[model samples]
Target: MINMHYTACSLLKITFKSLLTFFAREEREDTMPNTEPKLYKLQKKDLVACILRVFAKLVLFSFHRITMEGLEHLPKEGPALLLPKHCTYGRDVALEAIALHRATGRYANFLMRAIASRFYEWAGGIKIARPKDVRRVPGARALNRASFEYIRWLYLQGEVLVAHPEGTRNPYDMGALKMGVIKHLMDVENEAGRCIPLVPIGIRYRGYWVPFSRIEVKIGEPVYADDFENIKHLLSYLREQISQLSGWVI
Candidate 1:
């Protein structure tokens, strides 16, 4: 009734050969470093970006009243992830990042779909391929590989990243938070670098489609990346925190 080979394999949790191969590949890719500068750093300044930032502020301040909490939770002297509940169809969700810059003087780079006629390279915003659909394009794999490196570099350099965990904006529920970002965060955490925070944010709006509306940004506790063994656990913690803060059910 006892097979020694089976016992050892079971103890090792190596049942699925395909899963093992996938994880092995992922682990190998995760530990490697990407040194490309263009992918990570902005080289030139764009005037249009300056105008847009100002315009965004004007609309945020003049058209809407913004309130925020949990200022103390932001990382004091290290890189951190600013995961916010994206207010779909409203530009005001970005006000949370702007607010971070105002409070700490650290610019938050948004991870967005590829944009042309956008801000300068120095605008601190990271642009990835469009549609953000990872499965349909051959170039998507390449883009994602480069982006992983760039994002890792950003966090190590004490930069703040503003990304939607839900991947795309959803006006209704928070939508399902994806695991890709969390996996990368785990990779970043295990490397030898400064500590960073994975922050969860919640945003609520009233009269959002109206010309002017009020928004409340609630910042919750930060989850240290190195503390989790798997991305699923990390994602669960994130969903719970965001749900608790925004009253949005998971």
Candidate 2:
């Protein structure tokens, strides 16, 4: 009789655990991000528009100057991840996109924070909630996973992906790098048995938010996932490279 009772209790516990696992998986599948969002298409007029935008920025801002260095470091044709320091809240995003397009002749897929803006949506930006905001934001973790999956798809397609690891714009000082993207890349590399190039870009502004701001973009040499023994080392190396290029102290 005691053996029968113990067996029943064990069965009940196993059933309960199985139900919990099932529900958790169902929830995960429901919250997974949709990876097939319409991406931006390049047009000949886009180049013209970029040129006009540069001209307008220079003419209106007057003292605004943009200098790009080490652009040749960007691969002419291949999959690369661009990690640029996020500085200004405005125009910096556009400037980086324009710079990448001009340098590589490719429209880069951006992994950015969640936004409802049409421009970002139209540009096919992959949106994920910040780490701190994930719990507060609904389905934030799933969205990040979906974004990573989309990025992997972009990688397999041999396209450039740009993600700002610093989370938010830091006008002067550098911010701590996030490991989520790096870890995701490592996982992908492991599964695919290949190394992905990670390009560090540093953008510095002398007078951010002012018309007299001097903007400089420095593109560092490509670092691969296999270059470092571990993710921490890779992150540290990336931070150092970016700090040097942006003229920001570690």
> Highest lDDT, which number?
2
Give per-model CA RMSD.
17.6, 18.2
**Model 2 agreement with the true structure over 77-160: per-residue lDDT tens digits:** 877888998886435666667677667766666776665232343353567777886777677776666667767776777777
* TM accuracy, model 1: 0.74
Q: Model 2 clash tally?
A: 0
Q: How far is candidate 1 from the true structure (C-alpha RMSD, Å)?
A: 17.6
Give the clashing residue pairs of candidate 2, or none. none
What TM-score fits each model? 0.74, 0.75
Q: How much is the lDDT of residue 174 in candidate 1? A: 69
Whole-model lDDT values for every prediction: 0.63, 0.68
Off by over 4 Å in 2: 1-63
Residues 166-235, model 1: lDDT tens digits: 7776667767788777677667876855567889988877745444467777888888866877667878
